[model samples]
Target: MSDSAPTEHVLLTPGPTPLHPRAVAALLRPMLGHMDPEVFAINDEIQADLRTMYGTAPDTFTALLSGTGSLGMEAGFANLVESGDEVLVCVNGSFGARMAEMAERYGARVRVVTAPHGQAVRVEDVAAQLSGVQMVAVVHGETSTGVLNPVPEIAQLLRGTDTLLTVDAVTTAGMQPFDMQGWGVDYAYTGAQKCLSAPPGVAPVAISERALARFAARRTPTPLWYCDFEGLRDYWSRRAYHHTVPVNLHFAFHAALRAALDEGMTVRQRRVREMGAAIQTALAPLGFSPYVQREAERLPTVLALRLPEGFDDAGIRAALRRREISVTGGLGPTAGLIWRLGLMGEAARPAPYRALMTALEDLLGERGVAARFDEALAGVPV
Candidate 1:
C-alpha cells in the first residue's frame, strides 16, 4: 500500500455521492463482457430489486438503462407519449419543467400545471384538469427546491381515467418510500447516484403492465428507439443486443442495491428523513431557513435553505471545501439565492452530519446554532 493516507471527503452534492463500502469493493471485482451469461443474471437481479424499490408488481418490466437519469427521463417520455396525446405535466421546480419539455419533444400536446417553486403541486388543481389527458407526469422529489410533491394524491385522481401517471423519482428511490403499485404510478425512473450511494451512469426504471399496454396501443410509433419500451425490454428479457450495457456499473449498482435492502428500506428512509430534519432544524438559530416554507412539502433527502442576509456563498463554500466537505448552491432562478444540502446515502450518517454542524458553526461563529444543532443531532438516529 502507498504510504499516503486517503483523506476523508464528504459529498453533500446531489449526484455521484461517495460510494458505499460494498459498492467500492464490488467495483474491484473481475470484469465481465456484455455477452456473458452471468451478466444477464445480474441484470435480472437488479431488475427484481428495482421492482422491490418501486413496489411494482412482479410482472412489471424493469431494466437498468445504460445512461444517466436525464436519459431515463427521456426514455420514460418516449415510451408513454405519442403525437397529439394530451400530456399534463405538473411543474413545481426545474425537474418538473424538464418533464414538460420532454413530453413536448415527443410530439405530445403538453399542458402544464405549475405551482410556485417552493410549494407542492396541488392535487385539486390536477383533479380539475384531468379531462382528456392521456398521461399526467410529476416529479416525486423536486431536488431544485427540496419540495416533495403529493404524488399519491395526484395518482389517486388518475385512477378511473385512462391517464397514466409517470413519476421522476431521481432523488427519492432508495432513500424514501417508493410504492409505485400502492400509489398507482404507471412508470417511474431513478438514477443510481442520488440515494443509492453509487457512481452515476445507470438509470433503473420500472414500467407497469398498464403502461406497456398503453405503449402497445400508441397511435404513432415511439420516435425514439434506444428508450423505446419494446426494444429495451427485448434486450433485457431476451439478452438481445440493443446497446452495449455498462457491465462494471452493474456490479457496483448490484452491490448498492443489496446494501440498501440489507439495511431495510424503512430504516434507510428514516435515517435520510431524520438526518435532513435535524440538520435543518438546528440551522434555524444559525440564520438559515428552509427555502420551502411548509414542513409537509419539504424533501428530506435534499434540503434547500435560504441563506441568511449577507452570507458569503462562495467564500463559505470554499472554506468548507478546505475542510473536505461539499454542498451545492441553487440552480436556475434560485442560483446564489439558496444552498442545496444533500443528506443522501453515506452523507446522511452521523459523522458527516456532525461535521457539517461543527463546520457551519465554526464558519459562522454561531455557538448558539451549534448548541441547538447538537441537541437536534442527538435525537437523530443517523
Candidate 2:
C-alpha cells in the first residue's frame, strides 16, 4: 500500500506550511479588541513564548510586528540603521540579497559579502568586512537554497565591538536552535507561518538590550514609526497603542506557540532534522540530491533538492498541485533548477514524509526512471 500526500493542507510549501489543528481552531474563536484585557493577556503569552524560542533573556525586547517576515526584515534595519551608518550584508541567496537592499533603503551605507547561490556564506569572508561597519547582517537560514549560515561563529566575531549583529531568522526560528542571547546577536526576526505553524501576517522579533540601547541613541529619527522598536515594545510590552494588532492572528500565533512548546523545541528540531536526513538519504539515488551539497549546512525544515537536468520543473509542480500537494521552486538564480520541499510544523511528522515519498515514487514511475522508488527509500521513507 502507498501513502498519499495530505489533501487537507495542500501538503506543504516553504512558508505558510499547514497550521497546527489548535491554531485552526483558535481562528474560529471570537475576536477581541486589540487593547482588551484578554488580548493583553494573549500578548503576554506570545511574548514570553517567543523569547524562549529565540533563546533570549527575559528582559530582552520582543514583539509581533503586523506584517509578514519581510516586514520583520525591514523593521530590523529601519530601527537600527540611520543615514551614513555602514552596514555589511552577507548574500548567499535571495533573502540575504533582500537584507542588503533593505539596508540601503534604510539609508545605511551598505556593503555586501557574497557567496554563490547554492553555497553557505563563510564566516571568514564576513570577518574581513567586519571592521567599521555599524552592523553585520546575515540570514540564519537561506530557504532559497536550503543552507544554514554560521551565525554563532559570525556573532562571536562581534563580541566586544560597538558593531551589532542582526539576523534574519525567518525560516529557522522554531525548527533550529536560536541562541540570540548566548550567540550575542543584537536583532533577529521570524514569521508566524513557518515553523510556528501560525497563519501569515504576524512576524515575531527579538531585540537585545544592546540593540535597544543603540536604537534609543540613534542620531536621527526612525524612518518608520509603525514598526519602530520603541513603539512596538510600547504596544506589546506596555500595552500602549501602536497599530491595530491582528487580534485573530495573535489567537492563532498563541495557539501555535503552545503546540510547539507542547512538543518541546528540542524534539521539534530533532524531528525536522531527522526528516531532512531521511529524505536526502532516500532520494539521492533517485536524482533528488540536496541543493546544499554539504550535508552539515543544509536546512532541516526546507529541503531544497536539485531536479535532474531534464526534469521539467513546471510540469512536476503542476502535477504535484493536481494531487493537492504543494512544493516551492527556487527563486532568482536557482529558478527552474530546484524544488524546496518543506516538512514543517504539523507536516514534519512521518505521515507527511511518507505522503511525500509516495508521490515522488509515483512521479518517478511516470517519468520512467523507476517502476518503484520504494526500494530506494525502503523502510526509511516514512
Candidate 3:
C-alpha cells in the first residue's frame, strides 16, 4: 500500500451521503453471488422494506436497479411512452428539465410547464397544459433549488384523466414522509445514497398498479433492455435470469433501509425537519438565507442557501474543505448564487449541524463578519 492516508471529512452534500456505521460494516462484509438463494432472500427483504418506505400497496412493484437514481427515471419513461406520445413535464429545477429531456429522447412529445428556479410548479400551471397528455412528470424534491413541489394537488388534478404521474423523489424518499399510494404517484424512484445513508449504485424504484397496466398495454417493447420493467420483474420474481446484481451494495442498502425502519418513519421525518430548521436558524446570523422563496415549499432534507453578497462562494467552500467538511455548490440556474447543504441520514443530527455552523462562524470571522454561532444554535431544540 502507498504511504498516503485517507482524507476523512464530514459529508454534507445531497447524495452519496455519509454512510451509517451499520451500512459501512455491511459493505465490508463478504460478498454473495447474485444467483445464490441467500442473495435472493436478501433481495426479497429489500423489496419489502422498499415497498413499506415508498408507502405503496403491497401489490405495487418495487425493484432495485443497478444504477444511479437517473436509471429509474429512464426506465419510468421508457415503459410508459411510445412514439409521439404527449408528456407534460413540470420543470422548476435541473432534475425536472432532465426528466423532460429523457422523455423526449424516448419519442415523447414533451411539453414543459416551467417555474422560476427557486419556486415550484403550480398545480394550476400543470392543469392548464394537460391537453391530451399521456403522462405527467414532476420532481417531488428539486434538490437543485431545495424546492418541494406540491405533489398531492397535482395528483388530484390528474385524478380523472388517463395521464400517469411519475415523480423523482430522490431527495425526499427516506428523508421525509412520502406517501406514494396516498398521493397516487404512478411511479417514484429514489437513490440509496441520499437519505438512506447507503452506498451509491443501487436505486430503489416503486411502480403503481396503474403504471404496470400501462406498461402491459404498451404496443412496442422498450428498446432499453437493461432497464426493461418486464425483464426486471421476471428477474425479481425468480422466473428469468437477468444480469448479475451488485451484492455488496445491496447489503449496504438493506442495512440502511432496516435502520430507517427501525428509527420509524415519523421520528426520522421530525428529526430531519428539526435539523433543517436548525440550519436555517444557524445561518440566519450569517446572512445566509434559504434560496427557495416560499418557506412552505422548502425541502427539509436539503437546504439551498443563498450566498451573502460579496461572499466568495468557491473560496468559502474551499476553506470548509480544508477543514475536512464537505458541502456542495449550487447546480443549474442557481450556480454561483447559492450553497446546497444537505442534512441527511447519519449526518442530519445536531452534532454535524453544530460543526458546520462553527466552521462557518470561523470562516466568516476571518472576513470581518461576526456570526453568532452559540446564539444561532440556541434556537435549535434539543
Q: Which candidate achieves the best TM-score against the true structure?
A: 1
Candidate 3 lowest-lDDT run of ten: 366-375
* Cα lDDT for residue 364, candidate 1: 82
- Model 1 spans > 4 angstroms off: 1-3, 368-372
For all candidates in order, the CA lDDT equals 0.87, 0.85, 0.86
lDDT tens digits by residue: candidate 3, 181-230? 88889999998898999998988999898999999998999888898988
Per-model TM values vs. the true structure: 0.95, 0.93, 0.94
39-126 per-residue lDDT for model 1 (tens digits): 8998889989998888998788999888999988999888888888899999988999999998999889999999998999999999
User: What is the Å distance of residue 96 in model 2 from its true position?
Assistant: 0.5
lDDT over C-alpha atoms for residue 204 of model 2: 90
The residue pairs that clash in candidate 2, if any, are none
Point out the higher-scoring one by lDDT: 2 or 3.
3
Alpha-carbon shift of residue 247 in model 2 (angstroms): 0.4
